[model samples]
Target chain A: MSPSERHNVTVHGPADGQPMMFAHGFGCDQAMWRFVWPAFSDEYRVVLFDHVGYGGSDAAAFDRHRHATLDGYAADVLAICDELALDDVVFVGHSVSAMIGVLAAAARPERFARLVLVGPSPRYLDDEGYVGGFSEEDIADLLESLESNYLGWSSTMAPVIMGNPERPELARELTNSFCRTDPEIAAAFARATFLADNRQDLERVRTPALVLQASDDAIAPRPVGEFVHDRLPDSRLVLLSATGHCPNLSAPEETVAAIKTYLAR
Target chain B: MTIPAALLDESAEDLFETAPCGYLTTAVDGRFLRVNRTFEEMAGREREDLLGKRRFQDLLTVGGRIYHETHLAPLLRMQGSVREIAVDLVRPDGSRLPALVNSVLRYDEAGRPAVIRTTVFDATDRRRYEQELLHARRREQEVALELQRSLLAGALTEGEGLELGVAYHPADKGLEVGGDWYDAFWLVPEETIAVVVGDVVGRGLAAAATMGQLRSALRALASTGFEPGALLEALSEFSRRHELGQMATVAYAEIDVRLGLMRYACAGHPPPVVVEPAKPARLASDGRSPPLDAYSFWTDRPDASLQLPPGGMVVFYSDGLIERSDRPLQAGLDELLASVDELRDARPDTVASSLAQAAAGTTGSPDDVCVLALRRRPART
Candidate 1:
């Protein structure tokens, strides 16, 4: 399948506008950017897509070997950019995807103009001098929580959770398949996300970045975000007053404001 | 048993405190705004200890905190309400309480997320049940894998002037055993050998079982001195009589190395490819018939013969060899032909591995892929 089809690429905004691609994190699909992407749609060419095996992306395109590492997801981001012929792109990534954007930017620095990493952590496990705020046991417990929540992921209930109030007809026709990833794929993605150590990739990135850290993020705490900022050659950190990991969802206004301020500067 | 209006009014506060399920209200950022008696009891803490002092996430295990931040929080923001989220609540003594949580994100008059109202249900029993189901599914996968491994463990036929190689790759997505299998054994030891690649319908343990039955039936029928066509005809009869492996596809070939002759027949399968010395590889599409138990009007199964020149090679493979979701079958076949031609100089084993690797590119095949290559050694230098 073509990369566009494989990733379920969706485009919005003016054709000739500067490209702004939003990448969602581990827990959800492109829908995670619903509140934030619209804020940029007027001035930027917005691109949104689900990662393989998530949301609207073709599940068959999920190759276990390819997606076993964050590099594979980084390759997919580049593939999307290549398919759309996007350049000077402004990438806004959440949680794990923030690191994906990091990898992608480091691989091809010229393609990206700026990166907005929301709640990013170069690594989730604590290192010798760094504080990642989680232990190996914590991630294992998260996997167990995912196991017990399979009932919430069932086709019957996923539709209810993913329902589009404005388009009830579309919801009915989707068979509740949106975000219906196989449980195995979910676990593999979790491992890849939580276990990844991309601290060194930061040095290779030349693209100027904005780090949007939540005030009390349980995932990417303050020090981790500061570490990402310190590693990147040209980056600024903005700690959002919003608590929790997903400031985009909890405080889209603040998230958008932070990106707007970064781009304007 | 209806209560009086005055009594109902007085009992409203009692209902909130003594509800069957734990109920609480928290600020949008999870700071406890209010808690009922039931929620306090379930959390093993008093309202005074929780209210204004801790966020709901603080009451969860570390993993539950991460899950709350990642999945639960975003889901509540998007859907306005989330249902039946599994989490573990940490009590003061550190004992874990498996809980099912549901929360609604309520917006205020200014259209801002003002508060989150949540209900918590004790799910120790439900959690155990889910764990059992997960274990059972994994056990089933293991059993299917074991069955497939034991069945395909037999050694292939090998001898002087004959080179044989086989590669089998199961579908990688779920690690479920597929129906595709390859078998090579002596029909008349040292003189002629039978090499077969077949695909039974479906997957999992049942498909593995069906593949085993069909493999045994084909071997048994070949031992009766039946020709390639008759062997398949009998196999189809076996399938119909016993109601197993219906619509299974097979490509059966018998090679007599000394005589440089091959009798082959394809039963609803992609024809085997042949590459002669210094000649381009071509598909042997001559003898073909519908799948077993297809119930076609034409009952006759014809076998075709090919003169295996010195240094010639023949490969029998399941449909996965020439079928992928991303491309047309003809395209895949063309690629296979080109690949065989490119790898013509390689050994039989190298060619088998290379072809299988090429077919399963970066993304593994959804269906199992099997390749069995047989080459007649070139005239001794």
Candidate 2:
């Protein structure tokens, strides 16, 4: 379908610089990248937007079944890339979006220059031979918390759910209302994000990838991070001494520095 | 500045005897050679009754006695020290008390095991805390259910110009009702009507409370005949004063029954879907302005004229209807748009029931879906 006449997107940054697409996690919108954007905006064309239901987007367009798969989110990323006419794009996803970016890259490897996955996981569920750090009950508690108040969970859980409980605002700082999303949409996302097994998809990620890991994370532990690194054919793992699911919020400078160091090469 | 090893070793007996933790030394034959005041307090017996008479195993509860006879003593004999092992002791009154035990075997000069010294601490507070946490979660679940009931009540009220129907389903059994809401009621007889579907930031009681405030404010401002934008502006002003960190997105539909036309406004919300008998594509609302409360140099249009057939239904809803738990909000919207024709495909006599069916149960619902289905009830020809 042609772009909706009412839909208009503005891409602002250096026109000829390395382009990067950054996706936010649950409970947040594109604004989560604000602090990290300043470090690269002068040099790179940065892309950010609320997920369809969140932020300043149209909410009525949201559908439950179609979006139950991460591939749908992956398709949205590619659509945004296509709209911008981006090539050799450096795709960066934070938290869950990081996993979405990996799936997107695996689908269309040629469109991406490198994949910068921050706190990414192939699957959150523990398999017979695999450990995802959290048990079923742990995720149930998290879902219950999210259902109670996504913002409250983000603010309160950011401390314990992330590596550091001291900086609770980091959770509050990264959130966006973009999806203007319904609780139903959030619930669907939670089930798809947590219960779905995507271990098979990691093997197809052929693009040179950088897994910028937080030393301590509540959702993605070192083992899960390493599992992603080991599975991706062309990847490097760099664990920074950051303590949160959102490194972009917890350690913006260090995260930016890592991005700078990786992109520079 | 530090005490010498010999002095420290010699003073260990004095320190252990006076330490806040319960300490006791048992012989190889299981007789208690020494017992501290802390141990005496733990057992509810005097040191004189305990020392040189009771065995370490005798103080353990029945289950603890079995565990000690089969597992603990053997483990401690093999490992030298077992720190922080949880156990239960039977006090003199036969009340079982939970505790954590740390023990090490004392050695003679030649390194032979002479006696076993153990330390125990009360774990009642920790156990109580765990129980309270479980209870708090249970109480929260009940509160979430109550919020859901209130969210569903009076959500769809009919007015002179409009007929309304709404349904709300929290994601799960005990989830807090999210901020999604749909409402249509007459604030001023046939002259004016209020129709709105808006989403407050976050979910649960806080969002529900804010929803009530915003919804009530809209109704309060409705009689003044403020246009949708002006109405939203008033709401924004109120929110700014209250300093609600969360923002709200709303789509408002106002009908002037006497004029036979309706005006619509959108603020950071999805456009309302206008459904007619046998026509789906023929109906759609123009979306404008980002949601209210996020400060920007944006203005809202007060009116857009629309001819209404008496039996036509205009659906006003929060994002929950089309929201997918796992996908971007847009994808969910797209899916919803694709299924818009389904609303029209139903039997005309049962359209109201069909619309209710769409949102009745949340099989595919990820969030709370609030839809206000309004029918003009065309003239009886």
Candidate 3:
């Protein structure tokens, strides 16, 4: 399948404008950027997509061996860029997707003009001297709890979760289309996201990066964000007062301003 | 009888404190604004300790916090409400209380998200029951897997002037044991080797058991000198009598290595392919009959014979090798013929594995695939 079909790529803004790709984190799909991407649509070619096994992306495209590590997802990012022939692109990634952008830009440095890493953490488990803000047991609890919490999500809920936004009346019937994912795929992605350690990979990225750190991100805390900024070759950190992991949703004005400010530089 | 005015006045307050479920209100960012007495008691903390001091997430394990920040919080923002979310509440004593939570985001007049009203239900017993059910399901899957593996465990037959290779891949979607199976063994050592591929009617433990019985019946009947066609006839009778593997499809072939002779029959199965060096692969489409125990007018089955050339290859496979939901069965058959011809120069093992992998690489087949390739050794100088 074409990468666009496999990843469910959607495009907006002027086709001739420079591409600005927005990738959502682990929980939600491209809809996570509904409030943020529109800010760039006036001046940039906005690209939005869901990762495989999440949102509108084809779940059947999920291959266990290929997606076992972050590299597989990174390959998909590169594929999407190549297919669209996007260069000097502005890639905005949130939560786990921040590291996915890192791996992609590191592999194809020339394709990306700037990397925006929001609430990014290279590792989640606390190790020797560094604190990733979570213990191994905490992650185990998370996965176990995820197993027990799939009551509201089933096969019937999938189409609603992946409902078309153009039809507002249909979309209005259920508010559940936001973060629900296939239970098996969700567990697999949870393992891939929480158990990853991309600290060594951060140094490989030569492209300039803007790190958007939240004031109280329980998932990717301050120290973790600092670690990401410090490890990157050329990066700047902007701490936002938004109190959650999702600043784009909680503090969009400030998030948009931060990116605009970074791009102006 | 008229109710007392004093009792009537306290009823609303009494219900909040003594309700069966806990109730709380939290700021949009999840900090607790107020918590009812039931919530206070369930949390094992006083109201002063919880209200304004702790966020609802603070009471949960760290995992729940991640889930809340990543899944729950975002869901609340988009949908304006979430229900039956499972989280564990940590008490002052460090003990965990499994709870089910539901929350609705309330908006102020200007449409800004205001406080979140939530209800918490104790799920200690429910969690235990869920775990038990999951454990039982996993146990059954494991049992079915173990049975399938043990039944298909024996090595394929190998001898002088004969090279045999077999590859089997179970469906990737689930852990249930599928109905496809392959077997290769010497019906008469050093003379004739019997190769069979079959697909039974259903899945899971019953299908695996049926496959095992059919394989045993085929092996036992083949040893007693039943030809390819007669063997299928006897097997159909056995299936009818035992009510096992009814309507199953099988391809049975016997090759005489020294003589370079082959006989085969397909019972409602995909035709086997024969590959000769520098010659396009062709299907052995002559000998065909209805599936086992199928209601049919034709009683007697026919066996087809072919004089095998040195270095020639013959393949026995289940329908999975030549069937896909996205394309016609004929297309898959054509692809099989083309792939077999391309791999004719390779070893039997390579040919078998490559074919299985190619079929599996596409939108994966829901059914398991089995391929058994047998090639006679090239003529010696």
How do all the candidates rank in terms of DockQ, highest first?
Answer: 3, 1, 2
Writing each residue's lDDT as its tens digit, candidate 2 over A1-265 gives: 2112102233558999878777777554666676687888888887776565454444434545446788877777877777768899988887678888888888888899998898887777777999876566645644543343333233343234233323434433442222223555566776767776788888888889999888756568889899989998998899988654666764678999998899889
- The better-scoring model by DockQ among 2 and 3 is 3
Per-residue lDDT, model 2, residue B303, is: 50
C-alpha lDDT of residue A45 in model 2: 85
Cα deviation at A182, candidate 3, in Å, is 1.9
lDDT of 3 by residue, B159-259 (tens): 99899888888875556888888898887798888889999999898999899999999989988888899899899999988889989999998999888
- How does model 2 score by TM-score? 0.45
lDDT of 1 by residue, B205-310 (tens): 9999999999998988988988899888889989988999999999999999888899999999999999999889999998898899999444689999999998
Scored on chain A only, each candidate's TM-score is 0.91, 0.84, 0.93
Runs of candidate 3 with Cα error greater than 4 angstroms are A155-175, B1-11, B240-242, B294-301, B325-331, B334-345, B358-363
**Model 1 residue A103 lDDT?**
99
Clash count, one per candidate: 0, 38, 0
Which lDDT tens digits does candidate 2 get at residues B1-381?
Answer: 988786566466677767888988888535788888788888788878877877777776543443443234434544465655556677878786777778888879996668988889998786567558757866776775576466546534545545556555455322466777666677557655667888888776677778878877777877786776777777777777786624688888777655557777777777776666666533345646666668744455455557666667666666766665446876756655555556654433244345434643433354666666666755655
Q: At residue B229, give the lDDT of candidate 2.
A: 73
Write candidate 1's Cα lDDT for A1-265 as tens digits: 7888778789999999999999999877888898899999999999999898777676677777888999999999999999899999999999999999999999999899999999999999988888899899999998887777663366575455334433534533443233446677788899999999999999999999999989988899898999999999999999889888888888888888989999999
